[model samples]
Target: DEYLERESFETSYFSTVAAAQEALDKHTAASAARDNQSVTGSSAFSEHWDILIIHMVTSKLDSHTMRDWETERNHIKSIPTLEEFNSFLKNRADLLETMEEAQSQKHTRRHSDISHNRPKTFVLIPTTRINCEALNIPSHIKLADPTFSVPAEVHMLLGADLFWAVLSNNRINLGKNKPTLVETTLGWIVSGSIQVPYSKHNKMQSYNTVHCHFLNNIELEEKLDKFFEFESVSTTQQSRTKGESECEQIFTQTTTRHPDGNFIVTIPLKESPECLGDSSQQALIQFKSLERKFNRNSEFKQKYTDFLEEYQTLGHMSENTNPQDDKTSYIMPHHGILREDKLTTKLRTVFNASSITSSGKSFNDIQYIGPTVQDDLLSILIRFRQHKYVVSSDIEKMYRQIYVKEEQRSLQQIYWRSDPSEPIKLYKLNRVAYGTASAPYLATRCLMQLGQECTDKNVGETILHDFYVDDYISGNDDEQTLIQTCQNSPTEFMGEKC
Candidate 1:
């Protein structure tokens, strides 16, 4: 029994010794490969790695943990590899891992504490974005709110014609229903319904509806038309005389044009005319006056001769005779001269225009009154005094200088005859007539456009501000510069002199 036990113990000891020797040899080979100059096709070892292994037999009463061969057979006091004395530490990986876990737990707790203490925030939106598709809104609509609750007072304003409005989904729809134009006097209060979805606390009813007048649409339009009638003449002799007289007094003449974006002037006439209302009587008066003045009134004759020189019409009459209207005889509301006391008054002639012909169409209907170029008279006078030396001149027949387009001339027809025996002639005024509402607008608009086109900065600026009607007034600090502006202005703008 003792021999058997002994044999078994020997076998166990030898096997353990052999296994430890093999492990030692493998570790040595790896180290040798690292140190070698040409080991070829291997990168499995690092020269800087610090590696230590304990070669032990697990059987028997376990030996003391040791990393070196030179340690006591049962225990190791220190490592043997380094030149300096080395100490041994056990469970190194476990200590490092435990410390890392504690640090991670501490960071997580700190993050949770900060999150719990912080205040909450909210975002607000603008009124413009209530209809996202309609309005071109940018991203990042979320913004910091200045208030925790709604303001005590919020102001909402709507522009003209927008007083009657509809709001849906925080969006505003202005002038969905316009005000009723009842007559020339009472304006823009009408009845209408606005259909739309309602948003929270809308100012208007959930379904917006309004009402102003009780009259039917036709009656409303008719009554309104009477109050807003245009300048026109009649065919019957008596009506023509009465209409022309009324028309002569109706037009209100002023130099400044309002930028109404439309061309219509309201004239209210009240003074007595030099000639009677009757066209036949006026014609007789004109013919007699012209016959007597032709030999004696050289100035009158000169004007008449100059008018003829303009060749405003072919001596032959227009042949159009749709109604009682003959090509030779044109229908005009009235005839008269403007600003007779002014120096340029010699150039101003009355070329009365019929707003609506017997055919029921009106010339002023389609025309547009351009924006105002005339500044406030007080402002212009102030600007005119800006310099020491003031320069002034009158445009010669300003409206006449700008010719009426050929197609438009036919719209401006007139009546002319030398004597009772002569045929009453139909004549087309070749130029824009001063007596019409659009004349001032056309003349000033052209002049203003010309001024804008001027290249010289000073001259352009002067022309833009200096004029009122046919009158031109400007001033400059320098005499030569003023003279230069005066000289260049007329030449550059193709200005015609009286």
Candidate 2:
């Protein structure tokens, strides 16, 4: 019985699609005429889609339903405002949800073996109606529930193939993965629906849903490389004159090398360490926040101490020498309580290289944001969303895991004190500090190298392709395969295991 209802919904959806296609064919001449009048896309939609967009936007002019083509294109000739059209889409999405729920109830009555009272989960694929209708991809729209509500003008110029590619990929991905989501999300007991965002969606409890997105046939890396040429050295200087910012020049001149060849920047020497502006006070605030949290959870306090001990053992930080005339020392400002839930200052009082200094030069101003070697995030997300089973974890203290040569440690100085009366003690970070301009590039480059060195070929490939910084998000058809892949990774003596 449930199968029959699903089949009927799919049939209805395809029938509507056919109706749209026919309407487009009939109005091809009218659509071609619209070319001179500036349509939605920079390039006009191929003659057919232009007509279909108009029909979707103005479907109600002559009749409530489009049984056949409207005699005159006059009905939908006037374009609706983006807001007005969006409202229509919301109404459409709600209507579909209502229909789906009604059908589910009907199916429940006939299927005696299955529980009808299970929670419902929905994966939203909301876009404008035109995005669904006019965009071409020979995908058969299954009418279980679709929630498109974007502006009509936006969809008018969109191509059919692009639209079809996006929608089909998401549908196919969700169809493959739905069974994998069980237990905690109540997937074992609940039926999932694909939808557009609806108003009543927030009211439901015990609802667990994840979005699926389009994965293009072409690799993202290839597409990005083709679009944005990143092979050359690009400078940030924009025709500098008399008083134009010379921070870049200062940074280059001040940039030095340790005996071990690690690049180092000495604070308050060639490059002056900057104050954190309003954020400077955060150090005090974060200290108090931690103090307060310690009073509440002693266990958390223990974790914090253990974390610090682990950090020191990793050689990420250590005590600094006495203040000397030749040595440049800067009081690193700590703020925002280095917290999650409460204060978890990953670094208590670390040099804030990002802060704007008195000379109006920030540490970030001097550094080169090295060439981007990472994959596009959208590409990763889309690919990740497509699988039946997915595993996402983070590498503990990613930046700290890598070592900074001893000679370069002075560049990342900090000030810390146990109490207000206690004299602040100076320290030097022995590893790459967070909030530095090059941290992301440096860390990701190392990660890619690690991926290359990994023994498990499949895991190595996934590490290179799916990781976004410390976060590892990847998908597979089987859970055990994913676990095995992780176990084979080259994570020896990991300080903070993800």
What is the TM-score of each predicted model, taking all chains together? 0.36, 0.40
Q: How many clashing pairs does model 2 include?
A: 6
Q: What is residue 148's positional error in candidate 1, in angstroms?
A: 37
Per-residue lDDT over 1-498 for candidate 2, one digit per residue giving the tens place of the 0 to 100 score: 545665456445644654554454334424433532455554546444445554554553333222222322223344433333333333233222222122242333353231111111232323323233322323453332233223211111113334223332132223421311112211111124333334565442222333222223436535544534443211111122322224334334555444543344422223333322222344344456666676777666665556555756766678766545324333345432344544445434344566554555555555545544455565567667667788787777777755654554655565554444676566677777777776676667667655655666765677677788888788777889866756654353121221
Please report, as a residue range, the 10-residue window in candidate 2 with the lowest summed lDDT. 181-190
Best candidate, lDDT-wise?
2
Q: What is the lDDT of residue 101 in candidate 2?
A: 20
Model 1: ten consecutive residues of lowest lDDT: 112-121
True-vs-predicted CA distance for residue 195, candidate 2, Å: 45
lDDT of 1 by residue, 68-181 (tens): 222322232333322111112212111111211112311232322100111111222121122323222223332122221222222222221333233112322234432211
lDDT accuracy of residue 200 in candidate 2: 68
